[model samples]
Target: MSTGQVLDQVMDIDEVDLTVDTEVDVNCISKHRSKVHQHFTKIENKFQCNHCKKTFNIEKYGCTSNRLKHLNSKHPSKVEKDQTHALTQKNVILQAFQKQQKNQSEADLQRLITRFIILTDQPFVITEAQSFFELMAFGKTNAPAIPSADTIRRKIFAVYDEEKLKISQKLQSAPGKISLGADCWTAATGKSFHGILASWIDADWNFQQVGLDFDILNGNHKGKSLAASMFKVMNEYGIASKLMAITTDNASNTDTMFLELQKILSEN
Candidate 1:
């Protein structure tokens, strides 16, 4: 500021006596210059209200509580608007969380439906049970929607495929060769069947065994068809080359099938 501006703003200048015996004190001029410097160097503490777009500072008449009191008294509409906006944002977050929970419940229920279908080996189109499940879940918060029979069936098949892949991976990673035991038999209904089992000693030297397949012998259980079915399971498990031995009953067809399988294995 110019000298006149500083002189006009400094209250001490008005209190000075312009007597004939004394001039302006040099210390007073220095003090006024310090005041100007302090004015420029001062750190302002101010906050702006979001909703009202108004600024307030707490430097003069107490702390920030006065600014807050003034804001509430003068701009209540702006405070209400901010409160409403905050409530809206909270509701949005709540809705997103609820939606996520609903989706998770739906996924779990679909897996449960698949288990129900496969473990029971029941037809999917049991309308009575379907309606019962729907009624049970009705008006329940975050409950899964009851799907149609076809949808449940599809989920069951998908679960089957995923489990098959896991088991195949285990077979491929088995430490030693797997032994095979096959049997052909006539069921009570006179339907022909052939069953295959895989056995092996695991890394811990524990004996492990599982049924590989149980196929209906609609056609003749000749060497070619028997070999085809067995090999299909082996190849699917990626363990065809690790076959240690095959055992079956002393039937003529069984011997033929073994001979054919031997030739196929040797050739490959």
Candidate 2:
């Protein structure tokens, strides 16, 4: 063949190979590109923005970093109190609502009670409910009342006591080696009392206070009554075994109690 004709034939063969290779490469690239595009589309559809009440295409907010930022920028006026103070105020409102439901009709009290509960439990304070009447009459067209701080305090204590008892029971039921810690002090009445505390490590390796009892002992530091009081708390909590340790200050009665505890453990 002539030189020009030979060069043309070589070029035709090279073009044929290039065309076949490019088609395969193009198909593989197209497949991966389609997968990447679908993955992002799915993520965009699921996420929504809590602030601005806008439904976003992504799984999380694209504009702000966190809920706090959304609240500060979008809901500025409503975010007046810090998180802790707002929670405390909500607790006060819920307590008042729970107290007022006893003597009143449910139909008459539902809105006020529900509002009080929501305000008290939420992380914001719409308004304060200081008393039963105040809580009930709140948001009424004619008049509104505010609860007293004293009443709020009393309601909080009621909840506190109930929680304390539940915690004590949970500690008693826990299975593990327990310990007793004791401290002493003189009250304002000039009477001396010993405070005994029992504790144990839970499954999560956290030390929990299982039981506590205070006893007023007549200047007699070495009295059997103190030992009895300690034993009473242990028995009430159903702690039948000798604890791993008993921690207390240097007192003759405390020493005696340890010796007695040792004897009890030995018997078991």
Candidate 3:
């Protein structure tokens, strides 16, 4: 018999043979069509050729490889612009972060200044305040920007003067005979100096310093001049006769001055 006739006869004898043939044909068609669709889809998604402005299939050439070829051939300016844009974005982000950090630092400095004023009860000049903020912001060991020493000196002097006034008022009200102490020394600047200190016995009977003064002697250490300055200080404080006794560190010049001071007081 002929092969076609024999196959038909076999199919007619068993329907299962016909069903197997149909299944095989369907699977074969699906595989063939699937490969074609994949190839065309890749081609459709590919970038246009930079030199020719032509569309090409990436199935034959990979996307990255094709882009590299285009850059080397014709799109150098486009690549440069992309790189520049990325760098610019990065720089912008960095600058913004720095500005945010700077603002936070300023806020911290202001808070610290406020706390210092409250704790110390002292007012700071603008330059001193700036220096203090810099120290706190950077570190205690960090070198500060140069500031005018005169300005800092003025602020310190003002605070000291105010404190001195308060202390003097307290001393005026304190009861008891205050002792007077005097001394002389040469300053580092080669100037002769005389210092007078007032001390009082408190309720507990311990001597406490109540007032002090330093006089620049212009290189003179004479007993008379030192005694005159001491008397002036005592008279100003209305305590010339109120001193119970005077103390010194065994200097001959101070002993002579004390003897002169006693004679002056006796005559007065």
Pitting candidate 1 against candidate 2, the one with the higher TM-score is 1
Give me the displacement of residue 190 in model 1, in angstroms.
5.7
After the best TM-score superposition of candidate 1, give how far the Cα of residue 56 lies from its true spot, in angstroms. 67
Worst 10 residues of 1 by lDDT: 33-42
Clashing pairs in 1: none
For model 1, residues 1-268, the per-residue Cα lDDT tens digits are 3434433443233232122113323332222221121112212443455445455532441233444465568766655665686566555555554555565676787777668768888777752385667664554545667667888878877887888787677677789998889988778887778898889888888888888778887677787778777777777777887888888888788777877777777776
Q: Report the number of the highest-TM-score candidate.
A: 1
* lDDT agreement of model 1 with the native: 0.64
How well is each residue in 36-125 modelled by candidate 3, as lDDT tens digits? 222222234343653456555443333344454556457666567656765665555555544445445533544444445546765545
lDDT of 3: 0.58
The TM-score between candidate 1 and the true structure equals 0.55
lDDT values of the candidates?
0.64, 0.52, 0.58
Give the Å shift of residue 145 in candidate 3.
13
Model 3 compared with the native: what TM-score? 0.44
- Model 2 per-residue lDDT tens digits across residues 9-50: 333221111122232333222222111222122222333333
lDDT of 3 at 39: 23
